[model samples]
Target: MKRNPRDIIVRPIITEKTVAMQQDDNKVTFEVAKGTNKIEIRQAIEEIFNVKVSKINVVTVLPKKKRVGRYEGKTKGYRKAIVKLAEGSTIDLL
Candidate 1:
C-alpha cells in the first residue's frame, strides 16, 4: 500500500545515543509507522528530509508490560528506522 511521507515517518528520535550516531556515523534515527517497510521508510526520509539516503536499517520494538499502582498494561509497540546519508550530504535535524 502507498503511504504518505508524513504518515510513514512518525518522528525523529533524539537521544544521547542517536545524537552521537548522527555526529560520528552520519546516521539518524526515526520512529516509523508500524506497518511501513524498509523501502517506504527510505523514500519517506529522503522526500521529507530532502537528503540522499545511502542505507537504511529497520527494527521492530515489541510492547513491554508495565504496572501501575493497581493496574498493569503494555506499552505500544513501534517500528524504528536508522538512515545513513550519502557521503558529503547531511540533514539538519535541528
Candidate 2:
C-alpha cells in the first residue's frame, strides 16, 4: 500500500532518551501510525527526511491505566519506530 509520509509518521519523539540515541547511535525515534510495518516506516522516513535508512526497530507502546478518584481511563497506545540512518546521514528533526 502506498501511504503518505505524513500519515505514516505521526511525530518525532524527542525525549531525552531519544536524543541520546540519536547522538550516540545515529537513530531517530518517531511515533508511527498503528498497524504500519518496517517497510512502510522506512519508506516514509526516507522520503520525508531524504536520508538512507539502515535498519528499523518497532515496538508497541502499551496503554497505561489512569485514575482520578473513582474514574479511570487508559492512555492512548501507539506504535514507535526507531530508524537507524546510513553512515553520515542525519535528520534535523527540530
Please report the candidate that would top TM-score against the real structure. 2
Model 1: pairs clashing at backbone N, Cα or C within 3 Å = none
- Candidate 2, run of 10 with poorest lDDT: 1-10
lDDT of 2 by residue, 1-94 (tens): 5889999999999999999999999999999999899999999999998999999999999999999999999999989999999999999876
Model 1 quality (TM-score)? 0.92
lDDT of 1: 0.90
Supply every candidate's count of residue pairs whose N, Cα or C atoms clash at under 3 angstroms: 0, 0
Q: At residue 89, give the lDDT of candidate 2.
A: 98
User: Candidate 2 has which clashing residue pairs, if any?
Assistant: none
Model 2 residue runs over 4 Å out of place are: none
- In model 1, which range of ten residues has the least summed lDDT? 85-94
* Model 1 lDDT, residue 60, Cα: 93
